[model samples]
Structure formats: C-alpha cells, structure tokens
Target: MPIAITGPNGLLGREVAKVFKKEYDVIELPHDILDITDLNQVREVLSNHMPTVLVNCAAYTAVDKAEEEPKKANLVNGLGVRNLALACRDLSIDLVHISTDYVFNGNTDTPWRIFDVRDPINAYGYSKYLGERYLETVNPKYFLVRTSWLFGIGGPNFVSTILRTATKQTELRVVNDQFGCPTYALDLACFLFKLVKTGAYGVYHVTNQGITNWYDFAKEILRQAGINIPVVAVSSDEYVRPAKRPKNSALDPFPLKETVGSLPPFWQDALSRFLSETQTKECLD
Candidate 1:
C-alpha cells in the first residue's frame, strides 16, 4: 500500500519521503496541491491516493508569531490535523503526526513521558496540544511522535542560525537556561519509517538520547566545524522574545525504546554526522 506524505517539501517530510520511497510507493502532496485546512480537499486527496498511511508533517511552526496569530496557528496546526485524523479514521488508515516537545510546560527537572499531562504555555504549543487531543479522540490508528530542537538540511534551524551568526561575529552569546534534546530530522525520519512498519499506534517521544542547552549545542556545532569561535553562555532572560519558551523540554524515549526496540543515537553524535553530511562551511561571505 502507498503512503501519502503531506508537507513533502518540508524539512522532516522531505527526509521521510526519501526513506519511505525506497520501500513503499510514496505520494508527495504539497500545500499548493492540497491545503489540509480544507476538509473537502483533505477527503479528496485521501480518496484519490487511498494510502495505507498518512504522515502529517505540515504545521504552523512560528512559535512567537503564533502568540499574535493564534487563530491562524489553530487553523493549520489544530484544525488541519483534525481534518487528516477524521479522514484517516473513516478510511481506516494509520495516521503518523509529527508533534513537538513544547506540549510540556518545561518546568519539570526530569524528562517527560508519553503520558505526561501536557500544559503548554505558548500559543504554538497549545495549538499542537489541541491537535494531539483531536487525533487521540478522532483516530484509533495514530502515532503521535513528539520531538524537539530539530535541525536538518531543508530548513532554517538553530544549527544553521548559529553557524550563520558565528561567521559574522568572533563571539556569540546563547541561552544556557533552556534545555532540550536536539533531534536531527534525518534520524527522526528513519525512526518514523521503522515505527509505522511496527504497527505501534500511540504517542511516543523521539529525540537524540541526551540533553543540552542552546549554548552547549552551539559550542558543539563550532567544534564539529573545526571553528575556534568563542560561544558565551547567557541566561534566557538576556535574550528575550515575545513568546515564552519552556526552560526544560527534554523528553524520555523509554516508552518508545520499549515499544520500538531502540531509538536514534545521542545528540552530539547525530550533530557531528549531520555537520559532516551537509559540509556546511562556516563562512561570513
């Protein structure tokens, strides 16, 4: 059976398509081709493709912007997901929806579990939480995978941002207070492919095995690139944004491991591999 992938042009979706293409007949549907917000459009695509799996990688990811545009975020992240879930439920197809660690309030000192009571503080997080709830109630065959600090070749992520800034400045100041796992999109894509094949239909928190703050992540990026730039550690208050971020969003993939057998490697190892694969030369020019 074919697998329909929404947001096929996105960072994670692109990687997922690449891997899934090797095994299954992968259907790439972009927003321009099929806007998920429209219920009719979603049903049309589902009926046309008749895919066995629907992987939803599309979302309104602008965290700060969501604060001002909650409605827009809900329409895309919340309602869009609901549409897909309902369609899949009717068709009896498995729904693999990508989620985020922001679902947690970030106050917990320990890693969060799959069953953790989500109390998101930001608009983006709340929108995702709503999507999760909709999928849980609406679809029985669903894999709600929550990830964090994602960086890959396709998108403008934190790793790329740090590399860009480091090229211009000799020293950089990053937030040391906010903690989370840095997940490589390619790694996550591979894991998701394995997960769907296993028929594990439930919530899972998947990320690289360890945790680190943005400062540490930046330092590792520079080190991996063989750069000598000095990255300074600063508190989250030093660099304020319109939206509030969780102080700690690290999640435990123990349930995922127990169910899926294993997970991706540690963050540092994954970062090094990503840097090597992309060969992003830190250049100011």
Candidate 2:
C-alpha cells in the first residue's frame, strides 16, 4: 500500500515522508505542486497516485497572521481540507489529517481529549475546527491527529526562535501563561506513520507526554544549549497579539498510547535530543 503526504516540504510533512518512506511507497506533494484550495488539483493528484492513505500535513498555521487574513487561512485550512476529504472519500482511501490545539478555548486546566467538544476562539482555531468537521462529514475512515507546540530542524519554530534570541540577547522575556505540550515534529511523524499501519481510525491527540508554559520551555532550551541567558516570565496580557491563543492546549496522550500500543518520549527528553542534534549539525557546518 502507498501513502500520499501533502505539504511534503513542511516541518512535520518532511519528517513524515522521511520516516514512512522506509516501509511505504511515498508520494510527496507540496502546495505549489498541488494547491489544496483547488478541488480538481487535489482530486487529480490523489487519483493519479491512487494511494491507500493520504496524510494531510498541509495547513494555514499562521496564528496571528490569520487574524488579518481569515479568508486566506480558511481557503487553506477549511475549504482546502474539504476538498481533500471529498477526494479521499471518492478514492476509498484513509485520510490522516493533522490538526492543532487551537480548536479548544483555553479556559480549563485539564488536557483536551480526542472527543472533546470543540470551541475555537480565534480565526485560525475556527478555521481548523471547521476543517475538522468538514473532514468528518466527507470521510469516515479518517485519522484526525491533533498536536501542539511543534518544532523541528527544517522550519522556523518557537524552539529555534528562542535559541536564536538567547544566543544574542542578555534577557529573554517569554509568555508564561500559555501552556501546552512541546511536540517534536519527528516524533509526531513517527506516530502518524504508526496510525496509518493500524485499523483504528478516528481522532488521536498525539503529543509529547508532558506540558509546560512557553517561558519554562524557553528556559529549558537555553539550559540544554548551555546558554546562560536569563528567561523572564511575562503574562499573556503583557504580550498581546491579534489572534487569541489558548492558555492551555495540552493534549491527552492516553488514547494514542492505548491505540498505538506505545507512546512518544516526554517533551523534556525530546527537547534534549533535538538540542544535541542541532549542536552536532552546527559543529559540522
């Protein structure tokens, strides 16, 4: 069986394609090659490939920028998803759709479950939530995987930002209020690959097994890199943005664990490994 991965050049998509290619006939498609907003394009690509599974990593993930460009975000995240879902249904293929933690309004302290009632607060969140519902109606056998705080080597992410800032600045002020699981993209890619090989189909909250605020996460990143910059904690109100973010987007890992028969490493461990790899890469470069 073959697997087609959209956004093959993205952070998670890159890792997903790299990991899954070892066992599956992988078809890599980036946005320019197959724009998700065009239904015919999506259908043509899927039909040509005739893949058994479609792992959709394509999304409009600009949190704050989405506020100004809601339609652009919706075009990619909402309508784009609907096109893929319909195409997947027509082809009798399983759809592995990547989602975000923004679907939930960050009011509760507890982790969000796979079956939680979604109440998105911002433009990006609403767009993703709309996409989720669209996929459900169009495809029954869909793996809706929700993850958060993703970072990897191939893209610009929070971890890279913090590390870069810490290396130059004396004091780094980070938002302490918002909290969620810091998932490494490669680990998420592995979990997504695992899901496709199994018969289980539905929603899965796949993330690293722990949660921490951004401030602490930044502090830890600097600590591991042996950078001695001081991390200052600031509230959400202090650092306002156009899009409202969930204070807590931590996902429950129990369901994915039971489904996959294993769980990913903790956020701390993943962070350590990522830093070590980055350091090794920099030394070589």
Candidate 3:
C-alpha cells in the first residue's frame, strides 16, 4: 500500500519522500494541496489516497512567534494532529508523526527518555505535547518520533543561517547555554523508513549521538565549510530571544538502541554527509 506524507515541501518531509519513494508508493501533499487543519479536507485526502501509512511532518514550528500566535499554533500542531489521528483510527492505518524536544521543560540535567514526563515551557512546545498526548490516547498504531535541531537542504536551517552570516562577518556570536543533539533530515528519513518496515511503533528519540551547544555547532559548520570566520560563544542571557530555550535538551537513545538494535551516527558525520550531498560549495563560493 501507498504512504501519504503531509508537509512534503518542508525539509524533513522532502527527505522522507525522497527516501521512501523507491520502496513505497509515496504521496506527497503540501499545505496548498491539503490543509490538515480542515478535518473535511483531511478525511477526503485520506479516503482518496487510502494509504496504509500516514506520515505527519506538518507543524507550526515558529518557536518565538507561537507565543504571539498561540491559536494558530494550537490549530495546526494540536487540532490538526487530532484530526489526523481520528481519521487514521477510523481507517485502521498506521501513523508516524514527527514531534520536537520542546515538549520537555529542559529542567533536567540528564537526557530525556520516551517515558519521561513532558512539561513544555512555551506555547509551541505545549501544542506539540498536546498532539503527542492526543495521538497516544486516540490511536493504537502510532509512532511518536521526537527529534531536535533539525537541518537539511530543502529549508532554511541553522547551518544555512550560520553559513550565510559567516561569509560577510568576521565574527559571529552564538548561544552556548542551550544544549541538544543536532539531527539531519536525511538520516532521520532513513531511520523512519527502517522503523516502519520493522513495525516498531512507539515513541523514539532519534538524533545524532553527541550533544553540543549551538555555538559549537556553528563553529563546526564553519570549520567543515573551510570558512575562516570566528564563531564566539555567548550565554543565552547575553543573546536573548523572544522564546525561552532549555538549558539542556539532549535526548537519551536507550529505547531506540534497545528497540532498533542501533542508533544513528554522530551529528558531525551526518552534517558532513549533508554538506557533501547538497554540494554546499555554492554557498561558500
């Protein structure tokens, strides 16, 4: 049976489609084609596609802006998820939904596990958490995959932002307080495919193995690109933003390792692969 993927135009969605296209009948649906917020539209798409698997990559990911636009965030991340879960339940289809580390309050010094209690710190996090809860409660066949610090070729991401700034600036100041694993979209896509094929349906924390602050991530990006820009580190207090970040949000891979029998490679290796595949030399040139 075919698989229907929402947010097909986004970074992770695009990668998922690319990876799954060879093995499965992949149906790519962007928001312009089908807004998931509308239950009727969601039902119609699901009915027409009649997919065995539904991968929900669409979300309201504007962390800071979500505070100002809580309603829209909730509608897309929370209600949209509920609509999809209900439809999937009725259709007896499996669901693989993408989530974020923002679901945690970032208060814990240790890495977060699947069974960890979630207490989101921001509106965006809360909305995503609500989606997770709804899916778990309503749907029996679901994979709640939580990831963080994602970047890829299809969308503007942290790596691209840093590369762009490094070209024109001699020095860059990055936040060093917040810590988490940086995930590559392609790696995540491949892992998701394996999970589906194996039929290991549950919440799994998928990301690069090592954890680092944003400052270090920026420095590594510049170093890999052969850029000579100076990436200086600054505390979160010095570089304040509209949204609050967790001091430490590294995810533990005990469940993934135990279930999947292994874990994804380190973040640096994934980043290197992404740079090689995307041929980011254009950006440096």
Which model scores highest in lDDT? 1
Q: How close is candidate 1 to the true structure, as a TM-score?
A: 0.97
Compare candidates 2 and 3 on TM-score and give the better one: 2
Model 2 per-residue lDDT tens digits across residues 1-285: 798889998889989999999999999988778999999998998899899999998988889999999999998999999999999999998899999999999888899888888999999999999899999998898999999999988888999999888768889999999989999999999999888878799889989888899999998888888889878899999999999889888988767878889999999999998888888988999
Give the lowest summed-lDDT range of ten residues in model 1: 276-285
Candidate 2 — worst ten consecutive residues by lDDT sum? 251-260
For each candidate, give its TM-score against the true structure: 0.97, 0.98, 0.96
Error of 1 at 79 (Å): 0.4
Question: lDDT per prediction?
Answer: 0.92, 0.91, 0.90
lDDT score, residue 42, model 1?
A: 94
lDDT tens digits, residues 206-255, model 3? 99889999999998998898989777889989998788888888998768
Candidate 2 segments whose C-alpha is farther than 4 A from its true place: none
lDDT of 1 by residue, 126-217 (tens): 99999999999999899999999999988879998998898899899999999999999999999999899999788888899899999889
- When sorted by lDDT, best at the front, the candidate numbers are 1, 2, 3
Clashes of each: 0, 0, 0
